[model samples]
Target: MSDVLVIGAGPAGLHAASRALDAGAEVTVLDAHDLVGGQFWRHLPDDRAAADEAQLHHGWKSFQQLRVRLEEHPRCRVLTGTEVWAIEPEEHGAAARVHALSGPSGALRREEVLLTPERLVLATGAHDRVLPFPGWDLPGVFSAGAAQALAKAERVAVGERVLVAGAGPFLLATAASLIATGATVVGVHEAAGPSALCRGWLSRPWELASSARKLTELAAYVTGHLRHRIPYVAGSAVIAAEGNGRVESVRVTRLDRDWRPVARTERDIAVDAVAVSHGFTPRLELAIAAGCAITADRFVAVDARQATTVPGVYAAGELTGIGGMALSAVEGAIAGLEAAGGVIPRQLLAERARQRAFAIRLERAHGIRPGWTDWLCDDTTICRCEDVPFGALSLTEGATQSLRAAKLSTRAGLGSCQGRTCGRTVEEILRQSPGLLGTTTTDQRPIAAPVRLGEFARE
Candidate 1:
């Protein structure tokens, strides 16, 4: 029997693995986290740790069930706390060479699995998008998803007063979690204005009931915010943050339809911490390194069957783009069915298409506003890894064109995190500053994570 290697343990990865196993392939699922569920449907220590159904999304409950189902499969093997650093396509043999590291032991490991009947699935999800503003480097600043994780997994409060700033569903989910956990939401700032809801409504009539369901979900969140008396500021941006050491207060302002912050509407809201996001950029290190074609969103581009341009490689979930967990699960199943040489169920394929269409519409309507680069004054830091200032990158020759040029000039990409946090922001700043945007593609590296030298020597 051929072995299939699925590189992720989230819904997409697990779904693909389950399909492969059902089709008689020996499947091994690898993940960086110790647990099976990815960020969306995390497995907390106990059920009591999480909030009631109203506050939390329903997917979390379903993911919990998925975990139990995956565990019962005989053809499946789960490897958690493992990192896939590099992958070499097979030319002579039918198998691909995968190089990875186990997180806890820091040991390098290698596996060569066949590529024919043994398919490769890239379900490596996404990371939160961060926009750099003054004091973003402050100690108390966290991503919106990070705050939910902090409370759910680590059992710690991010802060008493927190600012949740961003655009999209994650912003609402994060704010709800924080408020339910007793954190005072000082203010919620969204880059998109009332136009976002209008666009959502306009699309609903054409999309049938799907659009209405999404609208209702959004309305419920808005109602919760209103009931709690939490102020939701739409068409706004967090221009700057100020504090001695940690975050103290943030400057916010009204934004025009074109995303330019209005000059006269500036206001400063006091808060001990800030949780901000724009959207999510696909975590494409492994996919790009493996030579998959990337789209404008920096997500690994795949066809209807979740197959990448590279043969024998399949991709699913947020790594394809941040379409949420339900979409990911459906995409995963479709990918797995395709990988196993089985016909995708007609119902599942239709569902995937509907969800994909909805995701694209949402992305277009709530697209990142312009003038976000305004947050980064010349003095603001862009590369948090190396503490490189926007001024430094702007001055460096050819750094204004793209991430690749900036990396060449300032060593911006040469960091431990591999520019995951700062890459999108740098690209946006570069595109806006001097009007130099050559091509939109993620920087691909051979190794996604660091590997011990000894392992290489031994090989």
Candidate 2:
């Protein structure tokens, strides 16, 4: 049994494991991917040259240092290719047991492992939040993060001509990555107007000024945009995609201040593929199952020490909120120290406070407005996994009040992906509906990811 078991190997989990080990705790880190670095530092193929690898990922040096330290730490053990399916909290002072399948996801022979740890840190991270648009279910359409992952992990281009559409700084990053892969990026459409983004930065000049490193990182994206002469469409969205079994072109529309499509502003842009993402939503299933309190904004709520409402269960990174790497590191360090029975330093707390304030500004600037719902036609496939159309989701006035109610009525979130892809769309639809005003909650499940029946039998 380890003193601390961190579920995730991202920046937060890595830092948390290091901190706990520093405090003389036996630390074990588990990650689903075979690599220690999470999506941000997605590892390149081993055959790739070091120079090529360095060119692809930023913060490679920092990640290398962390990886080396963790690997050398005698008290620390990092397990890759381990998918934690369930966390069973024990009563009467028993340590929590983390149930996991140890092997590649689709492997024929996977070992079932139960880890009992005194404290658990969840750094499960966030996933791309996608809004449903017409033809989104077609091939060649993927989330911006998915495009980045493919380029980073597989060294594959999503398409010859790709149009990246989304909101937030991530869009620029994805565009830059796609351009690096020699893809012909037609344009990058952002739903938020430039003025809103400018105001978000202006509102917190101190935070902006402190983010010199972030600005420096963004310089490459700006350079790529200018060099490629890619159209950076502000206050714009891809209203619909058209293709024959695969995306061929997208209809871009000028969005108003509230992100509603403007009339007579639709323009067709030809592209082989479209990458779209609104923002990020925290992966809160494990936290919710651990009985952590959720904030009004729907992220897992944590205290000053990063401890969740549930005892012995702490959360960091995007699980708290999508505050990027720096904030996640700070929160993870604090959580690790506290979880290992060490006092958190005042400086770390102050840093966390500053980063959190900046995160609020970011969230306000990139938050998805409900007006995108206007783009959905009655026949648009909102739940692609279940083939549930927008028209099928008819709620009687005041009849459906919750996400579960809506899901049951339309069978929208019941597919194999299990609402990971379509839950947000369903929630947004219900929120925008005139009769439904109930709070949207994160969907909770017994298993975090798909598990084979044989694996369960082994357990």
Candidate 1 lDDT at 229 equals 82
The RMSD of every model to the true structure, in order and in angstroms, is 3.0, 1.9
Task: Quote the lDDT for 293 in model 2.
Answer: 84
Per-prediction TM-score to the true structure, in the order listed? 0.90, 0.95
User: What's the true lDDT of residue 323 in model 1?
Assistant: 77
| lDDT (tens digit, per residue) of candidate 2 on 1-459 | 339989999889988988888788888899989888888888675666346676777777888888899989989899999998887777655346778888877898888878878899999999999888999989999999999998877778899999999888889888888877879899999998878877766675876666566667778779868988998988999999998889889999999878999999999988999999899988888787777889987888998789888889899999998888888888989988888888788998887887787788777777787788889898999888889888777533333576777777777888888888888778767766666656656468769878878777776
Instruction: Please report the TM-score between candidate 1 and the true structure.
Output: 0.90
Clashes by residue pair, model 2:
none
The 0-to-1 C-alpha lDDT of every candidate, in the order given, reads 0.76, 0.84
Q: Residue 51 of candidate 2: its Cα lDDT?
A: 64
Q: Candidate 2: worst 10 consecutive residues by lDDT? A: 394-403
Tens digits of per-residue lDDT, candidate 1, 1-459, equal 657788888889888888887777778888878777778755465544555642455456566666666677787778877777777776543435677656564544543222233578889888788778887888888988898787656656699999899787778878877886789888788888888746854655667366454666667778988988888888887878889988898889888876777888998888998998888888887777667888865778999889998777899999887777768888998887777776788998888777777787668656787767765677788888888888988888778877677887887756777777787777666776666866754457677777667765654
Question: Candidate 2 — which residues are off by over 4 angstroms?
Answer: 47-50, 92-95, 395-401, 434-440
* Model 2: lDDT to the true structure: 0.84
